[model samples]
Target chain A: MSETPGIPAPPEEPSEEQASRIGVDSWVAETERHGRGRGPLWQLARLWEYSPDPVKLLAFVALASTVPFWTNEGDLFVFGLFTLLYAALGLGLNVVVGFAGLLDLGYVAFFGIGAYTYAELSSSQYGIHWPAEATIPIAMAAAALVGVVLGFSARRLLGDYLAIVTLFLGQAFVFFTGVANPTVAGKGLTGGANGIPQLDPLTFFGYQLTSTKQLYFFLLIVVTLLATALYFANQSRTGRAWRALREDPLAAEVMSIPVNRLKILAFVFGAAVAGLCGTIYAAIETAAVSTNFSVSVLIIIYAVVILGGFGSIAGVFVGAIVINCTLEFLEPQNDHPEVKRWLFYGTIVLLIALLKPWFRPVLVLAGTIAFGFVVHAIVAATTAASWTSGVPVSGASWLARWAVIPTGSHGNFNNYLYIGLVVAVVCTASLKGWWRMIALVPTLYLTALVWENMLTQNGGITAFILFGAMLIGLMTVRPQGLLGTARVEIV
Target chain B: MTEAEITATEKAAPPAHPLLKLDSVDTYYGQIHILQGLNLEVQSGELVCLLGGNASGKSTTLKTILGIVQPRNGTVQFEGEDVTSRSTSYRIGKGIAIVPENRRLFGPMTVLENLEMGAYLHAGGAKEDFDRVYTLFPLLHERRRQLAGTLSGGEQQMVAMGRALMAKPRLLLMDEPSMGLAPILVERSFEIIKQVHESGVAMLIVEQNANVSLSIADRGYVLSTGRLVLEGPAAELREHEDLRKAYLGR
Candidate 1:
């Protein structure tokens, strides 16, 4: 099959040397860009990356600053104080992971250190009483000093090893406060698992912040100032050095950036910020419990940072707000089971609207309703009418008519229904075209049934479930977070 | 290194010391001995090429010199000063520069930024160093704003060399400069190396391309299985029939 005169003579090859360079360079570039994200989310993130800092900061501040004025104090505390605490924590983590590229899984320990330090000084547990002014600064300094020690110890450890060390440190912190509080003057210094109670509220001069509203605004000011300061710091020389080291530590070291020292600096900064957040939170709650600084809290903070985007301050702020608000909605104390039900169904409709084309959405909607009723009828007619006894949440009589409501006691049957519903949802997701539509019908009916009988009673777990799902969804769809720039990293 | 090597190096060291020397260096990657009793030298302001075939410990020598890998025995001396115990960054601080294999430029950084990293030791004269790099590789100056990852092979090679030059190094260590280039580009690269040497930068280059490397090298050493098999003036080494037959496979 020798080529004819014009048949491209086997594509004249570059010298082995030249071709090798080309192959390596192109392959490296292509591979580095392999898992790089794109589409509307990525594009939107890219646009956000180019936004003016002041405008972005001001916009976020304006939206957040209005929350207290328009919402109930409970809503304000939920959306404002906790969100700000998480945002600060997320920003601190961003410095370590996003800027310095260090995976510090024990960041929550620093938060705990701050909280406990504040508790120790201000709480009546050991009859040690101090003003917020002295206690908070001491807590933060103590936390930062601890961070420096950890950083120095872990300076030689790279990446995953560092992560392991930090994670264990976090566990150690929990153990210290939860199980190892030393006996001091006939009372436990840390109060063991019960934690120190009757803590002083944040007080300035003679005036004391007793209300959650005042605490919310106090945290608002702190978060805003911290965000602005962090933004400036990220733009400074140290920031550039941190980013360089993040890209390649060896190169940075070879380039005279003092890689080890910089790593320690990043750790110190992150710890100090976390400590400050913890003090404020402990003061507001008037208690400092070991549970407040567990791995679950770590995951939430990580989710906030990752969800917002790694390097962007704005991203972490937005991430904290969204995650905290969603979590609050799931809390049983919110007294609105209706909100959760509506959110569940609304999410289903949203998914359909997103997944299907115009006419198909209507078709899926109608199909899902009709299918639910048919299944309900089959279960009701064959079994007893009393069998469909598990009541529907809110006043959705139609939903009750459509879904199979078990008549039995609050029993293992609901657990089976929940498991079956999960399996159906998974199957529906895997199926394609008409098969998906067919699967969706039964999945929808099972979902309603489970919500009515199972998830309703188990509202206790709803917060964690929602947060877990949000994390997984975020990692899959847009790992860069809404405000972070999509970075192309070398393997 | 044995006592013989210690005494021999001590006696043979020239009054104007070699810019870089690896005397009876023994290096190992875990249990695998890579460089055994390997002695190599690059005299001040001269170009030296360490020629070897695959797995002949060529890259290991460069890494050892840069302190990325430590030799289990023997000493790495620069300007008659022992630097075997120095860290990689410490060596760089002492005016040693490296253009690693595959041109490991910070892929995401701009060309200018990569050069800036090269001049990290001397932040006071970065502008002057940038000008020098630009003078040597004008193409780099033209595309200084472009991310290094996006550059072509020839351009990246230029960037790598320019980055090394930016450090104002006393001894520049280049690993596999002609490794993956067209014959013409290889020649162009050699011309640049010759120019850098002409400007009084002592360089020790590691390469598999014996012919191209020896053509421009002032002196050459042929290494096989991490031990020196041949050493002479570049011209004599080029014509060494035994080396050509046994190692060069000419």
Candidate 2:
């Protein structure tokens, strides 16, 4: 390692003043240098770090407001509008999980409550057409009331127990709306699994938000207000109290902070924000469905929060944008099969490029391509003609020639290849140095084979699988998330 | 003692009522009893030390006084009010502060923020409190922006003392102030305790370092196995044979 010419030499016997001037101890300086990173991306991150909060918010809003002009109605609703909604919901969850250090798994129940409340009041199913202004506040209050009840019931529980109880609460919401839809005022309150449809658009004093563009703009305004409000809230006395309790509840309690009350406040505040987002989401979709509030939606919201960085107001928007856009781009309904295919391969290439020493990634990429051609030639020469005759999905003829795609039914050949791919991935990850590099050649080829044969057929599931992998990768690389400060645990 | 100094000390008599008092307190952790029918008190403007070895219920006594651990029976009176059932925050709000064991500083927070949390009850009027704390520990002011976790053990101890003082408590509960410090730092810490005591706030120092605690303390209580075995003036306890044998290594 010392023979490397580019690597800087270790410092020798520097004076105490010189060490202090560098702002780090001499022993860890090399590791610190590596961690700090370099190049344009790090410079950009530093710029972002130093910029004022309001300025960043203004810039984000300016960028987001132009979405309606560039995209059509469908794309705007799927990509632009949904991103804002999730950003709003993720911000609310951030309060409970990030600010107060509570793992509130049942947070989506509040979102469902808000949507259903709006549905009952403003939809034809209830025969009561209340204005948006009244229904939104009512929905928020109803959700906040339930939050208070849950917070009081679970006040004595901590950590895993709280997560369990909240998880049950979330499941209960889904079950009640879908299975045990109670009759209220001569109609099924939640309309069973079908839910309450044909909901009226948000009408503030007779100004209806009928068009998709209008709803998108309306949501943009709501998200901006919520983010700004939360930013200020994070700077206030209550914010400090919440952070104190998050760090050490016992210490905060002995320091004159009312822990239980502040905890309940966090629940109520987070629930109310989710409730507000629900009203707008209902307005945009023009319906309320039980399936919309399932555990899957909860997972997506959690993905947004975790990816964005906990306890950071700005991280929610960044996370929502990345997650929602990626999911939308991979959606089968979007009729963009080609885009998904390119994205899958592009991501693999990007990961390979990030490997250290530069030449490793280059070697692995070249070795995998050569190995794929060699395997294809051998398989074609040995196996039946039908075994090697297969076409690639989305018309990628080049990949079809290289990847082992079966032509006939092949009797679970895809399943076997997928299992083999998983094993190969595990082996590659466990090995090190040149052995790992040698192992990656087969793993990469197997991955391409599995993707071309099986994963492309189920685009939705493939999106989720890739999403999970991305989260694991991000967590391993930077557990602090994109915008959060790295915390030090004293124990 | 000098005749004139002894006369000066005698002329300044203690107030009528003690600032803090625990009357026959019994504290339990789950099923195990930690403090068994313990009685303790700290007079206003006095430095009282509670000396005990491991499992002697010394730390539990501090926790019980600060309301972190409530006694099963008997009352804890602060400023002559029965505060046994009050919450920890309520006790803190009523002017009972504690420098907890291990100096449980908020690791991720800045020194200034930790101090701010100590004065949480007196928010918006903590400018003078900051000045008072900075005056006592000037090093804290310089490192105010730095994270408390990054500070040296001695500096962390200073922050803990400054934090407890920020509450402006009438009676402070300190648990093992010299537990992790070097001998010289321990002496400096005891000196600061004396200085803080001279500023008129009462204190109850719980420690295993009986010799050092008793040197600056006005009164001392020795505990073993959840019971107080000795109680007297600090001068008398220093010369007590059993205390010297067990703690002072005479």
Candidate 3:
């Protein structure tokens, strides 16, 4: 047939190679245009994206499974086991916040429900000893039932409203389990403040998961299975529908997707996963305490999901590993003060290294060292000797002469120094060009001074503060998260 | 025969009922009454255009038909079944599809994935359905794997039209196909619309550009401030002095 005037004729039929390149041409062209001057990090990211899915999963599983072989029980439990638990929790929340685009802040309540349900069934408080095979499903179902109720109640709400309602529900669960402690069958059902204790170990079929190593392996297997299952689900019809709704609910509805139903399904699915994690966690700890499922735990889980990159399964594992390990290492009881000191300095150095033109990092480091020495020398010359007498926290004893730490009791001196450091950081951020570089020298010195005095003493609070700083940094630098694809909004 | 004579014969032999009918539908956006007791229809296999300038309730009429915005009064019937109380998804499932304004293609999704979403309600025969769309727009087949957002404006319009056709809808509702296109592409888009209309699917094209829409539309309705000002055969509407002055630029 003759083609109409002005309408371009269709191109010749594509060869197999050309056909395969159909949708990829533009992306390849885009990459080529922007490919120059990219660092190794970008190349590494590109490589990671190009690799097959199953290969990535297998590599992660293989690397993670070997932790039990090298590490002792204490390190394994704190680092290895907790990482797996949080990974599971992160995966669940990813479905809600990541997949369905629902900011479900009350997610941790489902975890609590699962823990309490398992505790009631198997703990000594209730005196009902059910096997793990039976109680796990029951706990999951219990959480799912509550999920349906919550989902229905908050069905009409979106974004912050949904978040607020879910937050209230979470707080209600904590109060019901911790403070309210309603009586069921003449016994305080929740045990009021002192949660149910002495829970039986997870016994599946015939084998019991007792030791930390055994439990770790069990969780590894479960998480692997969950990831695999979720991977397939994400590729299925439901996954597409979830993404469709996430992109535009109105458009998805007009295109024949039941958006409300999918939203509720996402909630219930996330709740079920959290419940399963809670059961395993309760089994491992041998207790179900209201304090265990607090807002802090919810924050940690959110940290993992955000760090991992929303809607990414493998990102959950990476996020959990990085966060759990860092938090555990910073614990005061961990007694790794020297390690913490080195970590603090190492991170600052890494941040400086990210500066462009190479010479900037060197200039900043040299300037900071000179600035610290000058400040220390001026204080020693002007003030009393006691002001410079205090020693460093750990192995950096030689550096005591540089950073100022007063010997005797100085009222709110450390507080003043911390406030100075924060003000310096804010000032440095707002400044531009050479002025900013000049500001960083004093800021870096003040950071060291604060770490040596106040922050080292309160490792727990410092860890959270650092975590918050990291999240803010990530948000500014890469709002798509570590592994997520960058999106372009066509306004 | 002339285009006017063809439209005259079509009007002479009216169908038993319209494939889609909105009878005195009253729609509101909160306190703002947008579509005030609007009545519209598209007969089987007919190409009808709803024409009006901005804020003329043209878009609102399309939304009311798709059940995206519920009407306070009157009814929306699809194939003689009242679907006013149904959800948007239900209306879509009952063989109604829309190429929404601004071509709200899921930007993050691939062109193929967006098309797959259009066929969400249909379970089987996707291979054949995909082939049908691919044959209609070969350029879509070429750029099928690219993200919908990355495509050019005219290309995005093609994806939107292809997406709607994937559902195999008996009636297609298009909202402003020529809004963002260049003059040349707008002409090309109308040609495609004419081709699609000839394939036996009824269409209700909501457009602000009256000259282009009326050229191919069998019948047209002129709406002004939430009210239908004029309605007749497209040839007569194009010749009407008021419409020619207001929309057709004489």
Native-referenced TM-scores of chain A, all candidate models: 0.81, 0.87, 0.88
Point out the worst 10-residue segment of candidate 3 chain A by lDDT.
Answer: A1-10
**Which lDDT tens digits does candidate 2 get at residues B138-167?**
999988877787777888888999999999
- Give the alpha carbon lDDT tens digit for every residue of A1-491 in model 3: 12222223333333523332445546655665454334654455555665678767876777777889888999899999999999999999999988899999899999999999999998787689899999999999999999999999888898899999999989999999999999998899998899988999999887888999999999999999999989998998889889888888888888888788899999999999999999999998998999888899999999998888888898898899889988887676776678788887998898787675568889999999999999999999999998999988775666988888888788888878877876777677667778878998998998899888867777677667756665765655568777776775655
Superior candidate under lDDT, 1 versus 3: 3
How many residue pairs clash per model?
4, 0, 0
The count of residue-pair clashes in candidate 1 stands at: 4
Q: What's the CA error at residue A88 for candidate 2, in Å?
A: 0.9
Write the residue-wise lDDT of candidate 2 on A347-402 in tens digits: 78978876766788899999999998899989999998877898887766887778
Per-prediction DockQ: 0.25, 0.50, 0.58
DockQ for candidate 2: 0.50
lDDT of 3: 0.86
Error of 2 at A17 (Å): 13
List runs of model 3 lying over 4 Å from the truth: A1-46, A354-360, A423-443, B1-16, B29-33
- Candidate lDDT scores, in order, read 0.80, 0.85, 0.86
**Per-residue CA lDDT of candidate 3, range B1-250, in tens?**
4567757855785556679989999999999998888888888899999999999998889888988789999999998899999988788888899999998999888899899999988952289888988888899988888888888889899899999998999999999999889999999999989988898889999999999999999999999999999988898898999999998886
Per-residue CA lDDT of model 1 for A412-471, tens digit only, reads: 777687667656766665677788777777777776676677666665674475356546
Compare candidates 1 and 3 on DockQ and give the better one: 3
The TM-score obtained by model 2 is: 0.90
A248 Cα displacement, candidate 3 (Å):
0.6
